[model samples]
Target: MTDLAALRAALQLQWALGQEILALVQREHLALTEPGQRSGSAFEFFRQRLHLLPRLEEAVAALRRHRAAWQQLSPALRRSDPEIGALLRANEDLIFRILLLDRENQQLRLRHGLLTVRAESHPHSNRSTSGQFSALA
Candidate 1:
């Protein structure tokens, strides 16, 4: 496949992974917010998030592998390619939402006296300069 095609595919994969991560976080929030939620359920949610974080990291790694190719394109070309631009924006939005929900979940978990897990516990998770989670480019 061409470089553009490869990058496009990578973005698609990252987007899908990010969507799953976001949904999982949202569910964790729901589980935490439930007044009758069992500790076991909360722990299960935490474990699922841990396992998925690494997968998200790998997906992000794949996305970054194509960053160079994306950077090689001219600004005008990138602007004109709606599919890629929209997909990238969608992935960024997902990453932001996951971070927000995860933060709220953490706070809720803290109120419940349950320990919190950090994404940094995963060796491969990327960090953006702004300290938010890395968004797939």
Candidate 2:
């Protein structure tokens, strides 16, 4: 039998991590708006976020695997498990919030001229080798 309670706890923990990531993105947006208000160096901010990615991915993958197992059960079994259903709904809501915040952050970055460029686009350009500051920066 699937352990509904353990799955629910995992979902809740994932939701909490999602919330934390959203908060971090918001803080980054605020920092971009107010340069002097930045909490740390850009390297530090990126490092912290990168550190969370693997753990977050693991939790999400685990939840999906457990959910798949639970879904194999009968409808009556699913309906009787109110806590699992509620937690699943709440986790979905958290994911939506995270996506929205991430989109907003991307838009803000674009507005501020932080556009991404492909390395292949400038193959032979040696502007940096000429002892001049890069306009790209």
- Candidate 2 lDDT, tens digit per residue, 82-117? 788777777767666755665565455546654344
Q: What tens-digit string does per-residue lDDT give for candidate 1 at 28-78?
A: 677778766534475577567667877866766665555556667888877
Q: Where is model 2 more than 4 Å wrong at Cα?
A: 110-116, 119-137
What RMSD, rounded to one decimal, does every model reach?
A: 6.9, 8.5
Please report, as a residue range, the 10-residue window in candidate 2 with the lowest summed lDDT: 128-137
* Candidate 1 to truth, TM: 0.71
TM for every model, in the order presented, reads: 0.71, 0.69
Residue 40 displacement in candidate 2 (angstroms): 3.2
Cα error of candidate 2 at position 129, Å: 34
